[model samples]
Target: MAFSEEFLSELRARADMESVASSYVTLKRRGRILTGLCPFHNEKTPSFTVYPETQSYYCFGCGNGGDVITFIKNIENLDYVEAVRLLAERVGLDVPQDSRYDAGLFERRRRMFEANRLAARYFFKALYSEAGQAGLAYYHERGLSDAIIRKFGLGFAPKGWENLRRYLNGEGFSDRELFEANLIRKSSRSDRESYYDAFSERVMFPILDLRGNVLAFSGRAITPDAQRKYVNTSDTLVYKKGENLFALNLARKSKAGSLILCEGNMDVVALHQAGFDNAVAGLGTALTEQQAALLSRYTSEVLLCYDNDEAGQKAIRRALSILEKTTLHVKVIRMQGGKDPDEIIKTHGPERFRALLQDAANDVEYRIMQARGAYDVSTSDGKTAFLTDACKVLADLQSPVELDVYASRLAEETGVEKAAILAQAGQLRKTVSRKRERDRLRDARAAAAPAQKAIDAVNPERAKRLRAARAEETLLASIMHNPDIFSQIKGEIEPDDFVTAFNARVFAAVGACMQQYGHFSLSMLEGDFTPAESSAVAAILAQIPNLADTLQECRDCIRVMREEKGKVGRGEACSLSDSDFLKLFKP
Candidate 1:
């Protein structure tokens, strides 16, 4: 439902833009604006600027400009009501129960979360039953304790197709809800039920959000030689495999100072059970940029503890490339005496695992070692090639001391001069800098294109009437930035005069906000517009002109819009000069 303006205004006051954004981004104050690396997209330089004075933000790199609610909606993948509710709870304000707002998707998502919660409970209860003996035995054989199983909400799916379906139905969830939650599947056979369980005879690992809500599950077969060893819940309304990591709910709270990135749920569980409470793994997919950004919010460092296999090494390298763009410090843990973290903990004990973590190699050291393996350094040609490859790795180091130390190490190992290695690394750094600058300029130009700014996905007419749309956008932006100008352009422009539907809606919303709140504010638009619409509105507001020609700009915009709207019907509007159009508008 739509919140009252008073409630939203209060919420906005309580949850300011700077405070809300600082939790996810490390923002630094520059005069009145706070700047930081945008969490929405990966970038080295800080283009995400938060204006505390106006309680808004805009990313110059990406065209994502919005208020605090918009920031939360985009960063957390939440809808308008969900984002508002999250912010409301933060400041201890209860969301109103008014039913004016269309909260269809939000209510559906709430039901989906509830269904997943109930399904997780049913699976957990089934794990202790006689039907789950094989699954329980598998966990025990893998050295997972009963307490750890309960801690992680580990469960089991019985060896039938309709077990979870029947259970959820008994819990008042319909077949459709269960299916939408990805807990059951549609049946094909004539004699079977309409829907059957999605997972069968497998050990269920509940994947939860950071708030401890069960979003989905990953199931592993109990048998050792099963054809399909693992099955994960497909992407649904509440869960996305690539966007979420398993066990982050508990890992984010660890005082361990760093997160242990594991290869699988079992490995994360094993580490957590062995007193490493900060272990987390991806949800049956490779580490993604979203997952890496999520990790950076909770910890300053990430230790890559992949298995000691070729596949694990490759995953670690891929993860390194993803995390390189973030500010998080990275290190790679080399598993010894076993294939994976679980096997190593079982074979060498937690103490040995601790030693392995302590002896973890920094990313640069690991890369250098990896490069050394590709060459025979004993030969002169091999030494030169290895040095060349090592210099590339060293060039990425940000610390001068680290560069010097690594350069010295490379010289000692390859019989090359330290100065020569440093010189090569410096040259590589210059080349990288130039390439990065070029890419940044290209991205900036693309973002600043007038076509991009004027085009609206919801209103295709904006492209057909590009000139009018541009003028309408400028007028709306000006009125929002300076509400006093609303009086000057009061009778000259109306929402109906706008050439595009989307911009018309925006004009009406801006007028309504100004009338109701005595100011142009984003809080009133939270539930009134969709998230995309809200983002587009914020982009418009970010175009506040520097020159104080509000009256002239508004008149010109109204004249253009009038002529354009008239031209849609009559050919006489094409013959009207600027002065004649101005006479008609009378701004």
Candidate 2:
């Protein structure tokens, strides 16, 4: 799926970076670049910058720098090929079908998509068949209507080993493709290879992406004797379980201002059927930071509608901790007379559940109530413990009026003086504020050296020869800033002369770009390196603004790398003795 440089260039030209970025980030002109708050990570101050000249962007706060394609890839959660296609469609340019494309990673993912799509169709067809009668009855017992079932593309996996295996095999899918899609499991018995359906006698729920492609499945067992009532698709080529929400594809389309976060697929469907279409659930996993960020993208708030049990309460706490870091407002939906949303809707009806949602508690209110439940506020020691927990929760409240309101309530409940409670909460708030500021300072220092910090995790030698690595980074950054410098430094520093493999690869790529286009931009490295590597390269070049004399700095940096290269056993510096390492880095 690789595009020609000319097509990419044309696409980049038609889809201006500034225009494209403005759709997501509220950017303001800053001399040669534009700045905005980063959408990748939550930040109060704007650190995300866009360089229209290079058709590139880099975030100082989160280090998510890349070309427009990379931006779309991360923002929309798509693969490289998909992102390119999206950008092409955006600019009204048809992606050229290049047969030279390797049928490796991208092709494998395509096959998985096809397999999942066909599997979903087969399951839905099976739901209406004789084998799926019990599953249909199970849905009926749960009160899911025919229209609601079809809207969610509900299906049934029949009881047997070869049901899906036989159907998909007839549909021209290889066993490997089905296995990779998590639709079937492979087995070897008596020296013969065999495959079987992964789900059996279960009501099938096809988890889809934003594009409405069936990515995976979560099945609830229909029979009583079946082990593990629910069996979800393992992470496959087409899906990462924790990275996706179950019904988000449909939920995203809901006009509802907030999303109701549920615990299971049934709860989501039930809530959606009851006119709460913005309900979504995790894919058979606990809430993830990634999922939380995904939720923040579509909604202004998230209503935690998990079950009314100990495990569900724990899940709510875990979810609040992650969601609190995002910009989204969060509330907890405390259910009554039922275990889960489905049970609540079934028992007291959806109207009662709707009323509960209307009166849902904010995260702070929820935390304070949880604290009250943890200890007896009437007793002295219990009152102290409750106050301590309540103050910790109150400390995070951003609004002064809200904090005082909660504090006054705590004082009234415990019969403690209102001023004393306020004083304790204020002290806790100051302590938390100091700790956050210290963390922010430490992170700022780490971010200052993002290039070295990023490489240190994978390239140990880069850290050992810090002087040489920094020099290499500067030389590369200079060349990226002014591609003409490559002509001057080409003879002085070749790829092999570099100490770091990643920098060497980038240098080689830069040399190739310079030779072909006579200029280099961050977009040239789009397909060659990973998203993280591209961001690191952007980070390296972000330091170039201070370089007054690019040609001389490039030469000076090249000289430093050459000096490091002249050392004996160049790459062995990382394994050297402490004194030897110090001497190797000596000026």
Candidate 3:
């Protein structure tokens, strides 16, 4: 249903920012604001501030800033409308039904979710029933407890084409919903509806989102002859492979600003059952940027607990690259004997695994270890080669402190002087910096050339004016950052008077916000424009110069232009001639 402005306003009023944020973060009063550890990124000091007066929250550490609806949307991984509906429901408000709302799509998605839920329940029942005796025995042999099985909703899919189909069909679910949910398929020859249970003769793990919704499932096969060891739910309308994490619902509640990232569902369950409740696993695929961003929302640090094999090391490296963009601190847990976290925990006990986590090394140290394993460093030539390759790896470190530390370690390992190592580091940094600068300039030139060419061909005079107007817009942005400037211009100027369309839009948005709320905020306008418009506004703000003195400068320029116009009207000889003016202003 299309929500009214009043409904949204009422929802915002009922959903107090402090109260809602306090549910996830421990807030301490600081004057009129509330200070807490940023739930979006890991930090020792609290940079996440909540302005209760304005009903908004922002993390200065990260760049995430928004109102209550945005908070719920980010924290709960819901879209804007869903966030609004959730908060409205929380406050006992009803959303008005309207024809604009696609009830059918909503119903279809809900039915798919329901189908997955029912399939999970049926699989769980089958795991313990007579039909699941072999699966139960397999779990028993693997040392998994009944409580653990129930905790993870572990289940068994019978080795038949129609087992799940029969159960879901008997429950009155339509074939279309089942097929769309990836729960069934049709036979090629006879057109018989066959249950395409993604999992069969395997132990199933139901993956739950942070909101306790069953989004997908992962299953591990038991038989040696199984074609694939693990089978996961394919992407559906409600479940995206890269967007959901296993057991995040429970892990986000961890008091420590750290989480254990495992390679599989079994690892997560094993850790959780062993009192490490802050364990989560990525989808049966490699860790993605979206998954890393999601992890950033819960904790500040992550311990990678992937397998101790070649592929596992590769995955850890891939994950490190993906996580490098996020604010989450990353460390890799190296398993000594076991191949994976579950096996290590089962063999050496959970305490040993936990102790290993405590001693886990950061990415640089882990990469050094990985390099040492790959190359021999005994002889002088070997040491020289190893250092050369390792320095390249160390250069990828984002923190200068980390780079320095690793450089020193590399010097020690290679018997090279610290000064020499530092020189190499400096050279690498310069090379990388120059490459980045060139790429940036290339992109900027590419973007500007098209617009510039269009302007040059169509209207050079207007283009020059537009560029000047852009300079003015930047000045306005700088002024807007200062509350005193708004007071100065409150009665004297209007945004509609701006010359360029881009500047006019930004000024209009800011002016409307100031009029309505008595103040202007950049975040209030995040969703009000398209991505391109936002980028244009950001570019203008970044390029504008002398913001504090912009008003006087703009007024002076206007006066000069008017004076020159008056001189031309008097038919006086200008700086050049009429032909010169024509050439300069010609479109």
Candidate number achieving the greatest lDDT relative to the actual structure? 1
Any idea what lDDT model 1 has?
Answer: 0.84
Each prediction's TM-score versus the true structure: 0.89, 0.89, 0.69
- The list of candidate 2 runs beyond 4 A from truth reads 22-31, 34-48, 60-63, 188-191, 446-450, 457-461, 484-504, 526-535, 544-587
Tens digits of per-residue lDDT, candidate 3, 1-587, equal 24555566677778888999988787999886788767765454576788775566766544455668778877766655567778888889887764544555556666777888999999899998998988899888877899989888889887877788878889999777888888876556666644454567887888887666777788788889999998888888778888888989888887867999998887788888888899998887899866786787668799999898889989999999888756668999988768987788788998888789888988878877887776668877777767776777766666888788888877776779877877776777787778868976775555445333432343333354654554445445555555556666656555545544555567778777666665654335656864345434433333223454555664553444444344444544456687976886788
Q: What is the lDDT of residue 422 in candidate 2?
A: 85
Write candidate 1's Cα lDDT for 213-286 as tens digits.
78999999987776798999999987889888889999888999999999899999999999999999988788
Model 2 Cα lDDT, one tens digit per residue, 314-427: 999899888876778999998887989898888888889988989999988998999989998779899999999999988877789998899888888889998998888889
Candidate 1 segments exceeding 4 Å error: 99-103, 189-193, 397-400, 426-430, 446-471, 496-501, 523-530, 544-587
Error of 1 at 575 (Å): 11
RMSD values for the candidates in order, in angstroms, are 4.3, 4.7, 8.2
lDDT of 3 at 446: 56
